[model samples]
Target: MPGMVGRVPTSAAAVPGARSAHGTASAILGHPWGGTALGPPDSWDPAVRAVVDLVLSSPVPMALAYGDQLVLLYNDGYAELIGDRHPAAIGRPAAEVFVDVWHLPGVGDVLERTYRQGESVLEKEAVLPVDRRDGHAAEQATFTRGHSPVRDSAGRVVGVLTVAAQTTQVTNHLESLSDFAAALAGTLTLDDVARVALRYALDAFDADRVAFAVDDPGGWRTVRRVRGELLDEADERLPPLWRRVSGDSTAPLAVTARSGVPIFTPDGQPMREHAVDRHDQKVRALASVPLRSAVVRGGLAVGYHQAHPWSAAERALLSASAELVGQATERARRFETQHGTAQLLQRSMLPEHLPDLPRLRIAARYDPGVDGNAAGGDFYDAFLLPTGGLGVVLGDVAGHDVQAAARMGQVRAALRALALADPRPDAVLTGLDRLVASLGAEAGTHELFVTVVFGVIDADRRSITLASAGHPAPLLRRSAPGQPRAEYLDLPTGAPLGLGCRPRTATMAFAPGDTLLLFSDGVVERRQQSLSVGLARLADVVAEATSGDPRALCAVATAAVAGATEDDVAVLAVEYAVRPSRSAAMEMPAEPTAPSRVRHWMTEQLTEWQVPETIVGAAVLCTSELTTNALLHAGTAARVEIDLSAERLLVSVSDSGTRGTVTRAQTDTLSSRGRGLGLIEQLSDAWGTDPTVRGSTVWFEILLPAG
Candidate 1:
């Protein structure tokens, strides 16, 4: 109507004026303004009574707003809709009490416009989103809101009245009708599908709790409870939800299972709605919905809270989630089972072939301690490089599980590939360092830094080049006759792979009869002393095991360790030939001779003794200078004597040249131009002048393997 309206017609009866006896429930209950009690129920008009009945009977929560305040309310269900803090909102400002709805675009403005202009406004499907106490998001609900102005007897607008009914439940129903068909696409595991469905149901449909239960021939069992209170305690209470007595059923699952469809229980009740709580209070609100799998016979129960009724939108959400969870759960379960088998397959791919090098007569023993409960990660491998160089590597992967072992295999393969490509000890390590830094260790683990000791042996040359990444040094045995003892070639502790790319290398020359043993720290680190002492002990044992064969030597050395080391141990050994007599002799040619003749003569002596090519060149050059000095200072007639000994080469040149007597000076000076003697002093093992009555004999010795 163009003018202010007094009453609106509907299936409901007409409402009375503001000052009349027909006031809202709050006003009738002695509210300060516009309060009046209706006549007894029997005395009231059937029409007005019917309207009252209709408002009370409706499941949707409702309230009446007169001007700025809530003046009427119906049952407890309607009062609780406003939440605990504001339940007794009657006579309070409608905007203040239900602030969430008052702030909606068309709600507050429409009410204000109706009061000012004496107009009436109608709104359909208004929605309010609210955050619940549990921090979950909830839709306050969809509602049909209307505002109408009330006029006095003189036809003057006095106040505006408002009507609202929450419609969230109805909306959910329609939405779910279409959503259910698309919820479970491509999901193959029951648990996966169930979790997805439960989440969507609780979030979209406003279900209090959700759960998944499987049929086990005889009964049902709850496999998972996505959301629900009392889940741990009330397990096995619901029959239809699960086929076997496995675990608890969530509120939503129990409700749906018993009702054979989604059930709404606004009051927290373990049984039917008609059941009353006579013993106690504090019952929470609850709802339960069932999800049936199209591909499987299992079902999931989705739950909701009791404090609020199910909104229409919420129903739609539950339907959609039901389908998705059913399918997803089945797929996840199957995939998880298959993963175990995959781990076994990976274990087989580890290195199965190890090289057996001679001179070294290498032996590799792999002990993956305590099988079954865990996967093995320790690894060792050796092979002959294309360069006739032998490569040996020993490493420990970061973990002791199957996944760790699998990853270890991959790392080992990469290392082997590098070994095959580079064949050089340094190159292989450089490649490994680069690879791990870039690729990274396995997931669910921190950065990996492996302790590896790698070596390259040139058997023909009797030499070895090795590199270490925080690994212990290899043991060496002096197989050269007198004392068969173990010695260690110490390598610096370079940072492990991916640790600042530090370079490391150490070289050792082995004689034919010497045995070189390379080992992990686990062998000796178990001693009472520190690592240094342990190394000494290893050297001590190797020295003692000189009489044994390669296998016997290994056994005896390993036994020398008092007890087992906590970590694994790896050892490799090589023996070389000894040249004892070659190092015994000495020779010196006469000086003052032509330089060519001196050189020629020095060369003859070195060739005669068959000194190693490395020291031969230097020895020949030094001999010529010493010989020429004796000839120039003491005259051409110099007596030369050569002493060939097992431990060194000693040579002397005696000349009758006298400059008083030349003493080996404590300090070097210009007058002491015997710089040639200084060269002899610096290069030879020992050099001195033996004073004689006529002249002095200057002699020096070059130490051989005796050192």
Candidate 2:
């Protein structure tokens, strides 16, 4: 519906500094509310009448006005422009045509300026396109023309003349050009892009609303919608077709693609009526604009408060915006794909194999950072000791990223070497410290250090010796037939390696029948909860899990804690038992006569035991070499033990003689002798003699899986 009109200057064309020459005429129109005139005007001026006649007779369809009134004019096209004007319109002011035009800044100014300047002057154009009666995106273009004056017959400018023509096509084309620019500028996210494109389409046709539908497996689905206040929240719940529409259009992206052209359906019929039975607030007239471009194959629908036809300009604008939307959607998809790849790669970097140790049912697990945002530096490892003890280690690097994880791997490898070389908890730490410090100075200035807990399980001693380098203490669970409880050990309390000169170390000895738990700080640190609280909770859960596997216990503990932790975690558990040595339980002889004899004997024994050929060879070579020394030096039949613990093989040789010197037999032409002890020293883990009541026990441990 047209709004009432008011007179005003054409501010856009006004000179830098100038007043209207026909100020009085403008004043008359401007003061309509002052109660000066009682009713409609009686007649029109001759000049105004001529302009009115031409507008009425032209096929373009037009409106005429003079001095703020719709002047009675020629008859032909005027009827359609005004809809249904009576004979009385001839004498009435043009203000009657509109409901509230006078209040609009630009429209009112143009009217006032023309009325004040009597010498006829052409007004700048105001174009609009109207669709046919049906709701569609196509259009009927219209152009409004006005005339002003420099002076009147009495040398005083007063009143103005105006004529309007419907030129929908050209106007719609220009509007489409502007929509292209707006679509590019107004969108950010995919959803936002869709809405902007839809809104542009509706604005092009001067429709009430715009809706976007995506094709789905089921059908067309309305995914996004935009509209005027009349249907404020109506589109929130879209029709099934609209929601699924995105999938139906094969070239939705192309149609929606920036360079893609949209398929036009000026008629609203293609769009199913949505919520037809719903309340008035939920229903509105609709128009559909189908897109089949390479980028956007989905269809877009424009809704109107009433059934309004589309104008050519409006259709053009809507199509241009659709193309803009298509490109945005493609960009969004690419971003999502890239992000998904990053997450997968990060997740695959963690270790896949876990170490198993004897006397200790060692099980290890790792969990990467949430959503795999970045690589985390949490790690856990277990290996067999020469003495059949389990070597367990857990640590966390300082940062979160692929670089930090790489550094963590380097440190882990260094520590693994140290574990095999020294076997002593404290010695391993010392070696790792040295390696970290000497890892090369040119690798960037950023310092790298790690908090670690390294410990060995002495299944024979029924205890564990653990050393810590500023790491969280391992959890200890002590249990009997019925008695059960868990306690946290105090960490060595020292600085992390690579930062201090002399790294401090503390070693702990696990009690008989106890379970040792090792973990990264992430396991016991939760946001909003103190570290101590988490530790206590973990202890409680482990105690409760006395009857379940330690791994299960860890899971329960993890679940018990809140899910807000931001760190990666790793855990290792080793349970101790008083059961006979793996060798003794398996009924292996405790003594071997000599290296040569032992080698020959093991070949047959291991073959029967189902050991792989390669492994049997390595085991025989290692055992024979160690046994030869005991026989030659100790002067006794050496007791041999081969226990297959989860991870390590514990070997011990005992003799009645006790001595510090382990000399290689003198050889020369009679060689093959001295090499026996040399082989033992080279192959076995840290070898030493421990005095027992029987004599001195010379023993060493080796890993079952040598690598």
Candidate 3:
């Protein structure tokens, strides 16, 4: 009656009627539609009556719209499917009843074609607007719908019947699961796994909050995202958004993680007493699933701010997602273990620290390939020679594996031994060449080869002698008055180390305020780029650099060339400063009086060097704090070294203990044990820590007043 748009009879009693219908058809007959389009069901044509009986008898969701008005009629199943549109929609037109979505291509067009052309149509995964009945906005529903043309007794098309089966939940879950697996496949570390899994879970599960945790030896490492924002923690020892929960805690996440059991709370009121945060108190539903794996144990928790009925399908999806996360966590754990071991082995093969010499500032950097799980063969070293000159070498073996790392270690050890014995660049290379040849012969492989550049710097003569074994030429940056230039040395190249070939030495003037850069091929080798082009690019970048500081130059060069290198990179830079640094060292015992003794010795040394009293006092106080920290926390004997230059005074305290780098204690300001770092931060211009092979070094620099 609401959508009657065609000519209608004045009264149902005036027409010759068909047999009486029943059920929904009986209701249509009882309606006050005598003056409406269809008049009454008892007065309808026989064909329309028969189709109505067929549609009403079926249990599947089915509906029909008849005649030119396309007036709607549906069974009880379809009545429930349309949500609140129920009986009111029964006699209305399809377009008026489904006003929000009747014009969608998959709905009105398909029905129109079926009614007009008498064609039957089937659409898979058709999208329709649906009311969720949860006081929220309407959501999209997916269904597989079939439409058939209803014909009259005269063989003319009369109406269209549509049968729909909802598939929204299944389709959405399957797609989300597939994408989750693909995302997890690229994760390689615990942090990466946590990030990917948590974000995906929050989106896929439609939860207000999500958390991920992994069991570690120290405690449980946890990350949480609440309402699209990752929670921040104040602990500087852990990574960002990561908190360490005690393993024995009674928290839901911890309980599930330890017992490998899932905990589901549909009504979270009972658990509100144990809430840890305001969000937790407001949670109306939650699901915590254990990440069960042979290599790692963890948990994932999802929370909702409104009440939710834990449906069976939802539970099954949650379990499946947990399984995927567990597998990814295990894989990441194994990769991290292997990567850590490989990196440790590789670093152990290189020098622990560069030689801290006067008049020469040296710095080196090494990075593994993109796949860091495999070891690389790049190595570098700098040591004091017996002839009072400095020997620096950077080399690369031909392969990337354990054997390559071993050979690199052997070659590096032998080169240092050879250089200390002769101190001549050419002699060192010739000896290294023979050793490599013997190694190759023993391994029964002609592929074992190395490319290296060795240089000897004589500070007294202001000169450097260089020799090469099929390595890239070294770049020299000369900083003269109003004239700064950078160029590569044209040294004669020989065959790589495993081949028996003679090497020639080239001499060049290494003036003060000039820097020399030595590097492996990875630094200058890019895909689809020529070596000469890369070298020229490096020269231009070096010329544009403002300072001659070896550390700054190394940083710039590595940042410029190694941003996306597939191979390992190694860079070494040495700068001859304008004025040579004067340095001294003393070893102190790990006793209570170490700090006092360090203070007195430092004051005496600075006084002997004619350092200003204010600068000397500051240096002594900062050095004392660093030395105290080393002894208190490291519990090992410490080595104190001081380097005095025209612009700054640098002091370092080294110990052979395994304690990690120290940070200023945020909560323990009053405690004497942790105050040393805070004092160092306030008193020094720059201060930091470096992890060494066996221990660590804590150093600070104080800038001097203008001369």
Candidate 4:
């Protein structure tokens, strides 16, 4: 290939810096194509030399890629286009320098066509993301390239010449526009979308602060600030934050809202001398753009804490950010309005509060699904049935939005009405299914469906009857008094509501220390596992915990799958208490004088049990001190329970009405206030606070003198 170029270049053409002004490219031309298949520059063809001369003289970005491999050759303009891979890129393979372009969707095909077939190619406004560096710094740059063939003096096409310019700035703005539009679609509130836009604007313009505010009749109200220190304009010495603009501008926020113009307040302005401005004096540059929405009108402000030279591109980006804020604000307003109406509809259909059953503790919790602002169909209810039975139901209508929530309300109300008429569990669900089937037919709803489980707990009969309609099974956990074992009660299943099927009921008898848990599918259904797996996890958690408190049981079950569930959740549970035959409990009023009455009541109960005289006085003292503390701190000596056995005398004072913990206080000489918990510790052989499903009971056991 060295002699293939028969004629050699003249001495004037071979001079080092004669052909180009760029030092690196000119030096490489002296020993050009080093180690490459092409020969030295002096033995180069005349046509290649002429093209290289034109490239070096032109200011635009251009490259001469010779031979089939497209070995790289460039001018000063091309070196700047190559970013950090400039100097080493000379005389190297063109594929290595333009490697990122090869990764583009169809760019490699275009280049191969020009190289193999000698076809010219031209493009306009095409998106080609190219990495300007060989390193991991992915500066995503887009470009428009012009490609044509370079021929020898004999007119035979040999290589391709490529002309390209970077369009990263324009592509970046378009990308931000698309990203901001997508974020605004699923947002739940104005604050949600405002935060999203603020984050994008801050990163895009490299500004320190972003805000969306309104100049309402009262004062300036800030919706949010993404970053930087924000001042609270509540001081009497300061004017409103919206009015403290640069120079003599009055209410620049209002002016921007009226004129739809962006206002800038650069650093060292004249009228930034007010106390309001001093609070934020570190603010070096400020730009306010107007935001207009159908529901609200406001202004957006982007600020920098250090000196900044405002550019037209930055101003345009700020305006675009404000537009996103407005559109998102309007959507949030509509969603909030719909969400409020749906919430009211759902709450009105469900019970205001669960009934308080005697000897049975009950607790229920409901949480909307993870989808923002869209109501779900999950519903739960625990009401007193007509025949001294409790009607507990958990239902799920299949959808999300106002329609699903409304259907849930309707089904819940119908279940209540049916149960009140006939307290049978099967009858309640059968009637509900029939009612839903009829309603679905009337509404022409082909997809209308509801999964429900209705249960009746008869305390008088000590029996529970539950019937399901394609719903999650209820769990029944049983443990003996002072034992720590639990299980699940498997109930029969049938078709969901609106699916016509003959349904059957399941009944089981239970005693004290047994718990019944009814919940919606959202409680045990996770995206990653099967429903049965989730149910087994629930059983394991219930077995490991040793509390009969329904709230504690629900808390553990919900926490086990806290972030895993993706639907609305509801949990309802009831636990029967193990009442002791030898214990007597009395409810006492919460008053300053209630302690004396409780102490007398406890003394009489101990005397009736023939408690020894030596410990009866101490037991009475312990009861008096605990009762007095409960009344003083918790606002109530809610209940006092006294139990007597052959060896121990147990007395408990419950202050379940309030939520302050009983703590052991330090000893003080003058003030006798902080020593009650410590003294209670001293008087009893063993003492602990027992938290129940509803409240807590502080109990103490005293060892009776040897009887």
Candidate 5:
């Protein structure tokens, strides 16, 4: 009876002058608290009374559960949340009153931690099922709840206080905005931006249709997506087509893009007045936000098929999304412009084509770094020396910029000039070192240095003399019977070019069917790996190559690495092989008598080479047919080259035409245009056509009679 509130004498109250309570507070004061763990109101501890007073005085939804049984007490603000269970719920156990959702993760766990461990918990967007009080089923409510422990005079936690705020709509909007930002961050081009923006807008805005448009040089580029389709039919290109829109266009997207204004219309009348097509006419409402950027102007528009009133929150989200897209578009445009110019400058400094020397098959390749937006300093060159030997060089400057490209051009020109003046490998490198030092002195920066490997190939000696100036060792791949061998050349390594030092040259036997590979550090450098490991990998990959051809070797070396390189890569490969024992070339004009002239020229040359008369006749006939075809189909000047090896005769006719490789299927016996190819294929021992960078080459090989 002492714990019961109704049995407490009116004259024996704790707070004698305290004002009369109201609402849930009044209910708490008059309820029967007999069997509850909290006992009666008059017999309750001062700590419990203080916490109850605090919960009832707050304006926000708050509740307090006290003692071991966890009796529930709340204010008028919290009573609305419990529906019809409030008056009878007062002074009752929380687990009994809210049995449906008390065991949920954030609900009961948060209260238990605060009560038993004296820990505070803040739970966001928690779902709780509460009675509807309208005779309908219970509805789930979302709330952000905070739980704090209540302490007594002895510094021990006695109860748990809970304060909650409904945040369903706010949480949804924040999540949507965050997702939109994340999606836009990965876009790298205008097409990417448009695709991501249109797709996200359709789902986030819940609109029937979404359109993203940007101002282009000629007109406007737009991409649209409907709710159920991937993209509009007319805009299916990877980068959608650009449609010209005049300044006076009445389309909502165009107007906002041009004027940098946002337009929102809830009624269909305004949309009808400015409708540009059938799609616009079907839109009942629209919201257009302008993309605010210093470099490019654009706009985004969301359309609804049914009437929809745009809320302030929705409008703000649209504006923010547009801003993100605008910034990304600007960045992509800048990168494209810079990358194009950098590539052009880097390529213009390199050799257009390698020298075509006898007994020396040469091939070179250049690839930019992963960041293609900047110019790199890697370079390669090959030319015929005055001494009749081949001069080849591969080098890298210390930076990636316009200045580095200019320096690369300077070093390349100087090396060629020095090699021509004095064809010695060491002398060429020494001269280059002086030039590099002078360049660094002029630029007033010691950072201007270069690594280069200069080599001279002497065909008669069957040897290549190489000198290095702080560059990676050149690789030598030997072609054996069943096992090929690859090893790095061991030469005296000198200081880099800027710091002058005497370079020593080493000559190695470059026998027939052997290849020499010169590459930059980019070809053998990787993240988190030692340089020796990369070098070993390169050697292994090169040794396993199927052929010793220079072209195939270059391709295999670059592809040996698995991913994009951090630095530019340059590779130059030279293969020593059995070339023509005797050769001659003649150029004929694209005239009616060109084939006659070529036939007579070929007959005289083959006769001088002491080719058998029968062989000469067949060779002259095939040469005539190839020359005729080149003039008729190519309509350009043709080059006739004839090479006589120890056991075969090679004839090739090249023309500077755009016609690709001529296949056997194209050589119909009935057509006058292809009769020559058919005849050559039948008469020659072996014949084929190859597509060159500029045009095509049709050649045939005839085996000589045995001695």
Candidate 6:
């Protein structure tokens, strides 16, 4: 350990008494190789003797391959280097000894160059396949080997002398550090960094304990270890002896902290009192390395319950590894601070209030492509326009990031303001296009653009007029309960905003119980399928709706392709219906008690509507039956709405369950249920059940006789 690994000499074997006072290779001196092709040990030439003398007594791993056949000779250190192949390879030919590594690129070539050309060669980080092999174990080892020529007294090359140092420990250290850095790259807390560092270091070193301790809020905390196992960080406690050591400047941790060097106690004598996991047991070895950093100064400690040969190389590695823990801790602290600010900024840009309107139901959702949305471009909003119409807008600005998100916020805010002021679908879109074009016209701007489907629904006219600015067509669910399947509004659309183009209005009838689905491309676009396939899939979902509940419809449509997207998805589903106002509606929890609450609500609503007493009980009975079926069959949050008008009085129950069918159940007098639908049919002027994308709604309209 004290002497340097000396350079190779020009000759060996010719010297008398090539003594091997060693640990491992001493057995080679009396080996059975004297009867082999390498010849008798006493007959070796002077050049071979000189090199063998140089290697036999050396402290480091060294080997010499002499003569034209390159027979192998190694020292005690090199015997351990060959693993299980030591004594057998003492005087074997080099080619046979290196059979596994001979074919590797430049493996034997480097030695050949030194032996033939009389030049010296140095190879750092060389990988060789020659550790051990007795049919059970063989491992790859990394080495830094030096190859130099061995020549006779006349200066003619006689052999090749090689010096090798196994670098697998250093390689493992660097690899473990790389893994630790990757694990902590996204960490936003000190606890996460500390846990990863301690656990990974303990595993990498195969030690009993590994810890990073600092003077913190409570006390010095170390990652606890017991029987070669690491303690969970959540349940970790301060080491029982650490409090005593923290006050002593002569402690290993304190000494390393002040000196910035690794302090090692290979023998257990000095550490017996401070060792063990709160058990007062003795440890075989212990080490503490200082962490010098620009953030906070700390130290990394490692301990072993078994005797381990501590080396300077290992101490140097531990010192460098401690610095990485400091870097990760600082990085996590910075990330947490930056991420919080980004969330506040994003929330401030989106809509907080959605208009509550009668004769219309709206549901909108926005998801960022990335967590915390450093920047995302998808946006949606629902608001009351100035012209007494409901305006629903959904759009996606091109690109992603804080810059794109900022541009999206600007465009979204501007679109909402313009729509609330005008309400004409075409007029608002035209204004938005001009605004985007003008914003980009400013010199040296990257032409930012947006695609949008802006629409206004007028309950009075029972129509929804839409303008698509190079966006996907809105799916229109115009089919009545028993009519044909729903279809998309296949209207001619125009260019996106900032393209210096105008868009024309595309209007379609939005009847009572009809729905219009607006969404960003992220919903219907996928890497595995074409846009047309996604469009067809969307069409199928929309075509299945037979009710006008916005939330239910949104659930069904989004469920088809929710978590499979890479881009952020924004959906705005608007269903045109006589959605009762607060005064005309009452919502209760969907449970066993819902039927009674709903019956009571029906009694109150009918009284307010001044319905003739003769039919009030029948209406209440029908409402109870429908509400019970919705809660039991759909397992959805249910709502019942009653709208009383001059033409007819409408009572409807809707739920959010996406599966199940509305069927006419045959019943006898013995049954407790199944009579509700029959009663609804017998009692009302017109009653029908419509099954929407997510769930079904059953409504009965009693025509009011002309006065």
Using TM-score, give the best candidate's number. 3
After superposing candidate 1 on the true structure, give the runs of residues whose Cα lies further than 4 Å from its correct spot.
1-107, 115-144, 148-161, 166-297, 302-318, 330-344, 351-707
lDDT of 5: 0.76
Model 1 C-alpha lDDT per residue in residues 265-319, reported as the tens digit of each score: 5656543332212211233554445556544444454433347665665555555
Residues 1-707, candidate 2: write the lDDT tens digits: 12112111123211222223222223323333323222322343454435544543354323445333433232333333343343334445655544344445545566655655444545345533332324455333355564544233444443443454444446656767665665656443344455556555656555554566543344443443334332222221111111222223443322342223444443333334333222223423443455544643455555555555566655655555555555665554454455345434433443444454434555455555554346678777777766676778888887777777777778787888888878888888878776666663556553776788888777666666777777888888876557678888765657677655344444556655567778887777877878888888888877876233344444455555666677876777766643423443112222332455566766776676565576666667766655655544444445665554433454555665422122222111112233443454556543334433334454544444533
For 543-640, candidate 6 gives per-residue lDDT tens digits of 76434455545655665553477677777888666445333766746566778888887897788767877668888888887776665445456778
- Model 2 stretches with alpha carbons more than 4 Å out: 1-350, 356-360, 440-446, 480-483, 501-515, 545-547, 575-707
Candidate 5 regions with alpha-carbon error over 4 angstroms: 1-106, 109-124, 127-212, 222-255, 262-288, 301-315, 356-363, 367-370, 444-447, 458-463, 477-485, 509-515, 543-566, 574-707
What would the TM-scores of all predictions be? 0.34, 0.39, 0.69, 0.55, 0.55, 0.52
Q: Which candidate number would show the highest lDDT if scored against the true structure?
A: 3
Q: Which segments of candidate 3 are over 4 A away from where they belong?
A: 1-64, 68-124, 127-158, 161-173, 228-241, 269-282, 480-485, 579-707
lDDT of 1 at 614: 53
- By TM-score, is 2 or 6 better? 6
lDDT of 3 by residue, 1-707 (tens): 11111111122311223112123455554567655566676787898788888776766667878777788887655555676665577677787876666666666777788888999988777666676556677666677788888878888888888887677768899899999999999988777788788878888888888888789675676777778563333112222244556779777888888899998988766337556568777888888888877778889898899887888888888889888999999998889889878888998998887887768999777778767788889999999988889999999997789998998999999999999899888898999989988998898888887999999999999999999999999999998778678989989988888788689999999999889999888888888888787788788888777566665566567766534677888889998988988889999876667788889999999999999998888888778777766754565688999887776787888888633222223112212333566667678766656545666677777777869
Per-model C-alpha lDDT, please? Answer: 0.52, 0.52, 0.77, 0.66, 0.76, 0.66
How do these models rank on TM-score, best leading? 3, 4, 5, 6, 2, 1
lDDT of 1 at 627: 59
For candidate 6, report its TM-score. Answer: 0.52
Model 5, 150-238: lDDT tens digits are 88778788888888666655666678878877877776666667777887888888888788878865456666776765343222322
